[model samples]
Target: MTAPSGTTPNPLEALRAKLAAEPAVVDAAAPVVDAATLEDDYIVCHCTNVTAGELRGLIHEAGCSSLEEIQRCTRAGGSCGKCVPLLTEVVSIELGRAGIA
Candidate 1:
């Protein structure tokens, strides 16, 4: 392609080429996680504004092995509920990576 006469490669295309060359930095838009572990480790916290780190910490501190126990110990699913789905997704992804899910 002529790149629109005077223009360089499309900014997006250039960025994609750069990213493709670097395997260390994952594309934020596409998080990679295992499927089976996600099913077991995912937790939707509707309360306490908790994140994956908080959930993981609670799980570790409380010696809990399940999401339900995590909720009970940390009150993470006890709030506005807007972030619950995100929380669940983060937990699933992280746990999958950790081989715990």
Candidate 2:
């Protein structure tokens, strides 16, 4: 493509060259969430002050079979909507372990 025969120069290539000269950027390390053991994962919800351990305990103590049951007993999903999925996952794992699935 001859740029209609009269354009002096292309601008895209110049912009690309400028960007290529910049230093490489690095990302900061993120904290790990275990999601397996009850002690390592971060439970952002604190209404129940429920840690992963306490959630596991609730499953055993209340015989919670579903996410709603766990939520009702511990208020894990009562406050914020963020941690509900995680709590559900943990409860599922606990129920599976207890042969209740």
Per-residue lDDT of 51 in model 2: 80
> Which ranges of candidate 1 are over 4 A from the true structure?
1-51, 59-63
* Candidate models: Cα lDDT each: 0.56, 0.66
User: Where does candidate 1 clash, by residue pair?
Assistant: 47-77, 47-78, 47-79
lDDT (10s digit) by residue, model 2, range 1-101: 23456676577876677778876775332223445665634563566677876767767776667777777767776875666656666777788887886
lDDT string for model 1 (17-84, tens) is 77788768545433354323344334444345454556666555545566556657767645765554
Model 1 gets an lDDT of 0.56
Where does candidate 2 have its weakest 10-residue lDDT segment?
A: 26-35
Q: Provide the RMSD of all predictions against the true structure, rounded to 1 decimal.
A: 9.8, 9.0
TM-score of each: 0.41, 0.57
Worst 10 residues of 1 by lDDT: 34-43
